[model samples]
Target chain A: MSKFLLATLLLHIPLYIYPILRLCYWAESPLWLTLLIFIPLVSSQYMSRFYLRKKNSVWTKLLRRFADFYLGVSPVLLISTLLAEIFVGFHMVTFGTAVTSVIAITVILGIVATMAALSPMVKTITLSSGKLTAPVRFVQITDVHIGSRKPAFLDRVVHIVNELKPDFLCITGDLIDGQGVSEDDLKSFKSVVGPIYFTIGNHEKYEGVEAIARRLENLGVKVLRNAETHFTKELQVIGIDDMDDANQVAVQLEKQTLDKDAFVLLLYHRPRGLKAAADAGVDLMLSGHTHNGQIMPFNLVVNRVFDMIKGLYEHAETKLYVSQGTGTWGPIMRLGTRSEITLFEISPAQESLFPSR
Target chain B: MSWLDEGADVRSTSLTEEFTIDLYRETYQDRFIPLFVVESSGRLRVVTDKADIPADCKIISLIKSDNI
Candidate 1:
């Protein structure tokens, strides 16, 4: 009620004034610029409260503090921007021509800042980099939770995946929200024509592993139920079912004819057993249980748990890249984090062993 | 357990939020079934009843089930 209004106003105010601020900054009008500073200053407290509600539990008091933090920063940013503009405008008003140039620079900086803050969900990631290696191009998309609110979203994603021209595709986990499992939605992956590999995340376990496994297999995806296989002569890819058992992975590795020198890629739903994978000598690992805090400030929560929270990292000579995910899980809005389609270009480490890319 | 990686030697804490009781009910009304639910205490349980609540765990969320 009161909270909702405050939240909506706080969220929408920035969205509303953004365009006006751009206009004022572009025109280099001091009066309009002055107005911009005041509006945010006055609304800052309300905005902070709004932000707090979204971050902490509705029942928690920390949310109120966050609101205060946001409001507190509003005046400072406005004053700084205003002061800088005044300094420039004073110098430019004397010259007249420099006003346009100053405004242009401000606009450019604003655009860059906005882009940085509102980063896009999709990303292109290279699995193996540097010189000398057989390159394997693959795309990994995790947490694609398609539902009524987000129907046909995969169609766009499929188009993007196809544009990348990946040799293979991997879905680490959470293909759907699990509640609304439909035949049409299940067949969405049919658009993915390449050798698609999958591993069950916690969500798949909710929908009946066997049923989901059969359905995915029907669509031509190789759903790995604690299984290992080789994609090429020099590459051995293993898909482990989601669990905490490191011994099971070791046992599975024992049965496989693993090429010690060849690249090994392991797909597990959660970001657990990273050290074990490194010890297992797995060349790479891909995971996506943490939606990287699908909403803003929540990612701070994710940062504390996983070493490689999102994006690429190296540990014990093994490269692990965690996807922020392609789809939103619960909330539709992603404030701080972007959904991603990670692309990996694998290249040979040594010329003698693997085939040329 | 669909989440824990017993195969690896290293283990880390779970990286997800608990499935709120409210969200679980909403998901059921919307007909979205949970694939699995792991409690905060590390108890892993799969959903056997379609009409039942989605996973009530604090550290995990649902990925899409392949079963249509």
Candidate 2:
């Protein structure tokens, strides 16, 4: 196994196993019970990936759901158990009581986190520019990860965006996670009014870029591959493909010209290249690949990589907005973070000197 | 002062607008620099580069008498 994979397994296996071992020991269960729990704990991650790839049979669906639920609840259980261990170490509680409290807290927090994941909140932001001659409204949904989330979730998302009545829509990337995404999965997008523009995410490349591009295009979503389109004289939209290379954005920007006078909105998959964009005279940049760590503590790690994790940040003359993703990537659980749909309203800055004219 | 052929060689290709603009910039080199582009309706504007030209607009190649 790769070093990263090995490290993940080493870290996660202990987290999963220790909690169950503690609870079982406190309950005076047989030693064999620890082995039983340990076996599944080690195998669950791989098993979940396997079941997720299977055809949509009832058995596979149920197994996948169970695996995902276990993955989601495991972190909470592990943390609670760790806390219980600390309490035991400090002589604050008996081992049996510590185990009971840990279980109860884990169960309650798990339910709350799962519910939060199911319902994504809408975040509205208004941006005004003196350069803008006209007002434009855009609804941005990123990291929807459609294959992991069923089409029903997309249907609800589309309804929400439609209700917002945006002038246009932008999907910043990770729209689909798996290769199994079909045209049928994207049928709901047809109901959304106005044009929809999409840029590739890292996940799309994994799922097969060519196929995803064709599928999104057939669904009436314009795929912006380091290209741009004009919405009006006052506004222009540009999109750059996601690249692993650090200099890719600078290279891509060199190939394209930006409207220095118009309000330029850039749809890049990640929040990088702020200086390059500002130098090229881009007004606003929107991205969603970070997912703002998707869960707690992970956010701390994610913050180390990305300075602008979620929400609006100003870089020189350019404004960057990173969404916390529109859908869950795995486990379908959100803790200490929210799934969000960002609504942006851009308008011309008022130049009137006197008020109440 | 004789004006260079205003028409020149206007070529078309089946490429994205950005790539096409990049191609024009490469083909013309510095002569392509500081060109004024007009919208489809013929309204002129100064843009940062050729890529800023609207997809439907026409690129008008202008050269200074002493420079080009």
Candidate 3:
């Protein structure tokens, strides 16, 4: 067996088995009957992920959603099964009691995580810059993963952005993951009030960058490709294409004829470009790739992986803001982390009533 | 996984657009997804369909596992 399939079987088999065993104990049921019921439930994730997934196919959507949802709440189910097994094994509780308790815990935790995923919270950050003559408000939405998301979701996001009435909108990266949805679905942005700017994401490249960019540009989005444009005489907007290189920001910035006098706002997809942006004298940098891990323990893992996983960080004069993403990626669930849309209010020193305040 | 794709730099070319996943099943003897390397940018992807592989992408190595 390839290491991947073998590893998958080894991991999923145990994760699925315990939950079934717990349910069997709860009903005092035969193993065969429970297996019949739970096998399809637990196995759908693997079936859809490994075998096939077509975005437009009904069967594919159902199977993928089933699996993706399981992928999200499986952690809760597994942990509950473990605790239930321990409780019954130690004779701390009756099998029925242990099983019932586990079910309750899993259901509650699952709902909480699901709710967190569904709701996108607005995070506001204000910055004071002496260079700006007036206040500018911008809303950032990233990692919406449109194929995994429906058009309704985008409509709601656009509605919220319109309500916020930002001067402009910035989509850092990962706007569209798969090609299932087309320009018709993304037409929700037509209702939006201001100019939209975007940078290339890894997924956009994976699906095909030229096509995605062309579609966005046709919709009047400024698809910046290692390119820059002036938002104002004092503020410049630059978007460097998403790359796996550590020095991507530095290398791309080196090529740009930077207006050193302008307050530079650089947009790159990943959170790895702070030092380089700072060195290039960028005042602000925006990114969204980590998704704040999208789940509980994974957030801890994401922290170890990226020096700056989520939220804002300052390196020298440059301030970098890494969003938690406006949508879930794989599992469509969030635990301990909320889906986010960030709003930035860049104000001139003159506008501030109290400079320190 | 994008980060993991940083250094692999493999892109292969196929003569025809008719290249399908069955072609992969024929050679790799595996039922799982296959890799596509974009010839232009040298980007590697774990894609499902032949159509998912860009026109310029090349098929590189295929990894196989026992049927589960």
Q: Compute fnat per model.
A: 0.00, 0.00, 0.00
Ranking of all predicted structures according to lDDT, beginning with the best and ending with the worst: 2, 3, 1
Off by over 4 Å in 2: A50-56, A352-357, B1-68
For each candidate in the order shown, give its overall lDDT on alpha carbons. 0.58, 0.76, 0.75
Clash totals, every prediction: 40, 0, 4
What lDDT, from 0 to 1, does candidate 1 have?
0.58
- Report the Cα lDDT for residue B4, model 3: 24
Ranking by DockQ: 1, 2, 3
Give per-residue CA lDDT, model 2, range A83-195, as digits (tens).
Answer: 88888899999988987898788778878888988898999999999888778899999999987888899999999999999998999999999657788888888887777
lDDT of 1 by residue, A28-65 (tens): 66986669654764455454344432343444334343
Single out the weakest 10-residue window by summed lDDT for candidate 1 chain A: A67-76
Top of the candidates by DockQ:
1
Q: What interface RMSD does every candidate have? A: 12.1, 15.8, 18.5
Candidate 2 local Cα displacement, residue B8, angstroms: 28
